[model samples]
Target: MIYNLTYNGIIKVSREHLSNKLEVGFNTISTAFKYMEQSKLFILSRNRSGKTNCGYRVILDMQHVNFESILSEVYHLKAYEIAIVKDEFKQPNKYQDLAQNAYISTLNGSNSTLNYNNQI
Candidate 1:
């Protein structure tokens, strides 16, 4: 929902607006928005009427990763390159293979290994 709202630019989304769009309860939407706000993923503001309005501001763009469309844009990049970059930035010392193995092992009951000698 945040992704959709912030896709093009900052969007002011109220709790009622999100609840109506997602077909969920008002408290559920508010809680989710609060979680995202606390995580610094979005900025929440209050209007003169004291209603909630959330946005991913231009300066506060840590919410970029929430956009599925952005990920789809990068899907054509080589998998190894993606893994290497993610490992280097997000998980130091862990190669793509090791990361894949660990992730798969968590879900599939099989271990994955890293080819430490290979440079992705």
Candidate 2:
């Protein structure tokens, strides 16, 4: 239920709302959520509006250290690194001359004045 609800972009969900769909009492759902938290399977937050009013939001934790989690972290890191490298090396076909000139200028000297002027 949580997976289905969160598969879209809804990060926050209530315990009562979950319980109603599952056809269980609020306490039972709350207890199961508490167990999941204690086992480090997921993270849970209080409703903050007391027991009668609000629903708890569930957040999936990234520190589980499982193979799937490790793979996910590695995949994300590699993707971002590739994107950064791509952005750093990007040059328009029409502006290739300008890009090459800039690259050559940087390679020609470590000009502190030019670097400072560019930053300013």
Candidate 3:
């Protein structure tokens, strides 16, 4: 959802709007936004002055973002570290393979290792 919204570069939208669009509760969206902000995926600013009902301002710098870090930080999934290692190989084309292997390993409750040469 945040990825899709990146096309706008920076967006100002209410938590209620995001909740309605994602079909989730407002508090959930709010918490997710806090996580996202803490993860450095984006900058979140609120209308704290209370003068107006304007929404949050989200500033995204997609170019320098490490999405795997965001996933690990925000979702608290250590398995995404495999994705970070895969990224270190500079093999963007094999990202899907590594991700799938990581998921499969998690599902099978095994700790599969990857070689430095990018082999699973």
Candidate 4:
């Protein structure tokens, strides 16, 4: 269902929505999403400064990582003719938060403006 509903690699799927659609528990949908994320089959949207909705991007075309080409070829989009989707983490982000959070202790009690010079 998600594959059929997806548009331009972007899909707005929620745990509850999937649960209702698939006739399964919400937790089941959540676990399935987690497994897909770990396997790099989906990219869940991270909370941004102003984004208020919960959504995700589905990577249906595993053979192509360059999403711009999908727009050009499938959607017939021109480079200068439109605005692009503002995807923060365009690729798989399964362990991105884990790695960043693991090093947060080093940033505490220090001026964040100063450079650590790739120490983390």
| Top TM-score hit | 3
Best by lDDT: 3
TM-score, candidate 4, is 0.40
Runs in model 3 deviating more than 4 A are: 47-54, 62-120
**Candidate 4 residue-wise lDDT, 24-99, digit = tens:** 9977877776766665544454432356655543334332345566647655768753244324325556665554
| Candidate 4 wrongly placed segments (more than 4 Å) | 5-7, 46-66, 69-120
Which structure is stronger by TM-score: 2 or 3? 3
Please give the ranking of all candidate structures by lDDT, highest first, separated by commas: 3, 4, 2, 1
For model 3, how does the per-residue alpha-carbon lDDT over 1-120 read when each residue is reduced to its tens digit?
A: 555555544456777777888899988987887766655445456644476666464444334345455446544658756466445445344335654554332335666654343454
Residues 9-76 of candidate 2 have per-residue lDDT tens digits of 22456776778788999899778867655544344555456656754674554233342343345334
Q: Model 3 Cα displacement at 83 (Å)?
A: 30
lDDT of each: 0.48, 0.50, 0.56, 0.52
Task: Give the Å error, residue 8, model 1.
Answer: 3.0
TM-scores of the candidates are 0.39, 0.38, 0.44, 0.40
* Candidate 2 residue pairs in backbone clash: none
